[model samples]
Target: MELERAVGTYLRHVALERGLSEHTVAAYRRDLDVYVEWLRARGIVDAEAVTPELVADFGAERASAEPPPAASSLARMQSSVRGLHRFLVREGRAETDPSGRLRPPKTPRRLPKALTIAQVDDLLDAAGPAPGSEDASAAQPASVRDRALLELLYATGARVSEIVQLDVDDVAQGDLLRVRGKGDKERVVPVGSYARAALDAYLTRVRPALAAKGRATPRLFLGVRGAPLSRQSTWLIIQAAAEGAGLTAHVSPHTLRHSFATHLLQGGADVRVVQELLGHASVATTQIYTHVSVDALRDVYATSHPRAR
Candidate 1:
């Protein structure tokens, strides 16, 4: 089979059948483009012409390129190539997977940065007036909505993409939120009181006003123009709150997620339970929070132990 045709088939399979997000599919496409071009340069346009040696050379060439790529980027690129060849072989379009022996470089394990509880409090406060305050009633529709957005982010430990994708009906179940996560997987997460109150305020008090400004939509969160809240807009909402709270550290939506998981683990929530709440397909992904908790314990021991240090 023509290598280009096989690549096209694999991309479509991943996007349509595997249900990968557009962003993820686009990354795979980019890496495959590079791989295809390199193969064409070597006068190899058929899938059967590919060899393990050629694939290994390609990996070495990418690894040794001037101004080297980050380990994660290199790994992802290699995975993209490997996935393509494997798919071709599995589909019987190729006799064997030439990229089988190609291995991604090991990436450094970086711990997620989580905010202290007080800092989260400050950030949430900066999002809007307190839920019961006189100012809460007077707060702008956007302010009420921003507060609800931040509160929900920490409450659910969901990805920003999942939060922005929520619809009005998705939150209708009292004290429970139906979150659609990666690959369209749905999970029910319990909503805390603070987030529920903020959501109620947004839904009853603010959302109707924002909804009136544009064409009818079922989206739970809306912009000043009443369009569905976008992921970029959601990020800006977090950034503005971080600035308002005088938080020096870089903050993003994932920071709230990390804090949610770390705090839960510190509070003695089981890692498997956290995994379920987080919609993590594997508990191994949730175990990283245990490391963050251990580090916190070490900090306390170093400070409180009188004979230490």
Candidate 2:
């Protein structure tokens, strides 16, 4: 009862005082709950009685898990235990923090996957509006909307959420686009002539029809009924496009993002400039393209080298 009471207080402290997000607090609670249940299963009732052996066993069980838990997840679990024990010590409920000495297992990082330039082109071409032959009574307005979505994604490499939130006025110029990023920070990225032409087509022939209402709405992408385009709907558009293009890989709007950064990097764009275009908060985040480049080189080497197999 005492340990349970302490756990509740600790949880409140993490939630109210630490100001961690609800998702994070809920996650910590879940991990700690699992740990406590595992302890109870072993008939270890007292917090002080929880030994290094128990912790080690838990770590080993988690590490040796099949379809193994990721190292990042294991690290989070370890962090939860450390926090719980530290709370117990602080409240004078325990004499030692058993989890203090525990270490999480290290795991290898998976390299990022990138599509070829030709594959990217195929994907983009596939992303355009559905054919008139497919649906004889087809809506040309929606077709324009779909084409604009594809063009904007490839043009700015903006996140789907950002793209869907765009205003028709935002894409007026073919030369530049203002992008709102994380924390509502905004930046201007240049758009190519191809994207501009697509946007012009949509604006001229498509947008006004979808948006029959005279009210001035700021949203860029519009639904058939003229509301802002949703993230879920954007996902469906990308999937349909990939299928149309006969792409075997699972692709998303972000695949275009990866392709955008990759193609730019291959074309000798500076890492910092790519960082700005992607609106990555850190240059380190942009350096991921370098990894993509290395992976491309590896694929070439594997194909060309005599003993690469």
Candidate 3:
């Protein structure tokens, strides 16, 4: 059978039987399409014609190309190729998987950039009405909502998707927030006093006004038209707040998340505790923040220790 046709069959199986999300399936399809094209160029359209060397050559070709693909992209492409060959073998279309031994390129560990506590404070202040301003009375419902959204993001370190998915009932006693993270996994994270106050203000003063604009929904954050806030809109909100705070650095929801974890680590929180709070599937993922804290300690030691220089 043609390798290209077999790729289509595998994609369908993943989408329908494995229940992978459309977004993930589409990504696999794109990567596999490139692989198929590469195979066709070598006059190897038949599945049985594929060899381990051919797969290795494909990786080398991508790596040596002008403006080579980033390590992450190359890794994803290799994963797609490996999955395709494995599927073909399982289906008896191929006697062996040529791409089985292929390994993904190693991506450098890029530590997440976290904002300082002061910067986070400034950002939150910018998201709401300025203190002692006469126009405080004129502050819009959207401003209140923005403040709550930012506060909740920092307080829980929840992804923007989780924050937007929140329902009114998700907030429980003791200022706990029940967050639904990736794969619909639920975890309860504590809300700080500042965040709780911000949420209270938005819920009591702003959400109702916005909800009146359209059909009522259980979503925590709503747009001007009362629809659930989109991920793009959430990013824009963070960007606008950062600009208002006079922060030239690029700030996104993930930045707030990084800050939350880093600040916790700097404050002596356990890595395992942070892992649970962030809903990371692995403690190894949470340990990255420890490196951020170590960097901070080194900076402090260099500046404050009298004999360091």
Best by lDDT: 1
RMSD of each: 2.2, 6.6, 3.4
**What's the C-alpha lDDT at position 197 in model 3?**
79
RMSD (CA, Å), candidate 3 to true, equals 3.4
Better of 1 and 3 by TM-score: 1
lDDT of 3 by residue, 224-246 (tens): 99899988999999999999999
How would you encode candidate 1's per-residue C-alpha lDDT over 135-235 as one tens digit per residue? Answer: 88789878899999999999999999899889999999999999987787889999999999999999999899889999999999999998999989999
Candidate 3 residue pairs that clash: none
All models: lDDT? 0.93, 0.78, 0.89
What TM-score fits each model? 0.93, 0.65, 0.84
Candidate 1 residue spans exceeding 4 A from truth = 299-309
Tens-digit lDDT track for model 2 on 204-276?
A: 6777777785355778787877777888999998888789888899888888888789888877889999999
Best by TM-score: 1
Measure candidate 1: CA RMSD: 2.2
